[model samples]
Target: MAPNDTQVSFALAEPPVETAPAPAEQLRTRFGTLTIKPAHKLEMPRGPFGFSDYTQFALADVPNQPASQFRILQSLEDTEVSFIVLPTAADNEWIGTADFEAACASYCFDPTTSGLLLIATMRRDTNGQVKATVNLKAPIVLDTANQLARQVVFTSDAYTIRHPLEL
Candidate 1:
């Protein structure tokens, strides 16, 4: 499925529930203290690469950037374990529909129900200019229906681990 077909909508203002509400947990992250509800938490059977021990994570929107495509994938196990991610649809130049579908299929992810998020990194170049790059080779496939996520690596040469963003 194409990225557009898998777009997930996040309702910022949750509607009132009739039943007892789930207790919200607060965690201190690099972004500051974030209140995470049970619905916003994700379980990773196999955590992200290099961080296998940490399986629980909370998906939070970037504070003060409601319209931005960026999101915070904060690990519940550690305060310092957080990453900025962008939806695959945000940048379709490198990862085509075919490549994305293939990668998701290998991981048994339903392209129709699963969404992709690319890990983003920033650094200063020799010119003293900040450059941002996204890891397209390995993206986190989120099964929104089940709130389960896992990192899948693509073997396609068309994508790179660090694809420079033209920001």
Candidate 2:
């Protein structure tokens, strides 16, 4: 009876790194087959500002956009109905002096938690040039956790409908 002398030492295997979750589901629409990550889908509690017919929308990043500050919110029901939206915080200067924290507080949303403030995009003719504007009167506050959006309007008239771009 001889004892084995060649026992090799073994190390515990390391866990694999976490990877992005699989696509929640696929949506076939005007944007083509979009493998929707759950986060991209959104619902409007009362629908966008004046748009009441549609309740469901998906946020999409524009392909090859220069500024990359705009997102296309495509209506689930209508292909032709879509909105170009901008996050107010995208540009620090564009974010007016209005009380955004108060607005969020009124809606029971805390931007520090799971919330994003956005505005509807508007096109304006500026001295023979077409420029983009954002409606600051009513801002769409998105709840990242519930995916619910509410277009909250401030009581005071500090924000206007046409906050045109400085450029």
Candidate 3:
């Protein structure tokens, strides 16, 4: 019967509602408009050669590519910065008969989950012909799951930086 022991609960004020962050959108580069789904965006921890400024890139599929495994890596920062990349696993003849998995392990990479080993190719020369070489010594490993990527360099002489791209 004594109301002195218990305190009555009361609410006269409301808390502010929090807003959710906006969804990520595809970055448009000079190459062309890109539309990389949220899950397909590849995040490069260390940008490519001389490209220390930009890290974000989208894997864009090119029509009538030299090979079915070839794709375009469009830089979101600079429109002029784009690389023609190909997965080594897609065609062994392109990279050679080296131990691809061993090369990944040498760089502390996991072949099973690291997505794919992509070799970067020069866009083209003044001759208007595709560069007849690809970087076999170093490959860009795309971590599709975490959207992360890194360029791993191999010291072995087995692979060359400019292997003739007969394609």
Best by TM-score: 1
The 10 consecutive residues of candidate 2 with the worst lDDT sum are 1-10
Q: Per-candidate RMSD vs. true structure?
A: 4.4, 16.4, 19.4
TM-score of each: 0.79, 0.67, 0.63
Where is model 3 more than 4 Å wrong at Cα? Answer: 1-28, 63-68, 90-109, 115-117, 120-131
Q: What overall lDDT goes with each candidate model?
A: 0.75, 0.58, 0.58
Residue pairs that clash (backbone atoms under 3 angstroms), model 1: none
RMSD of 1: 4.4
* Runs of candidate 2 exceeding 4 Å displacement: 1-36, 90-98, 114-117, 120-128
* Model 2 Cα shift for residue 79 (angstroms): 2.1
lDDT of 1 by residue, 62-127 (tens): 766776666789899898998988765423556677777776677677777667778988899999
How well does candidate 2 match the true structure, expressed as C-alpha RMSD? Answer: 16.4
Ranking by TM-score: 1, 2, 3
Candidate 1 regions with alpha-carbon error over 4 angstroms: 1-18, 126-128
lDDT of 3 by residue, 45-81 (tens): 6787678787987676564342344567777777788
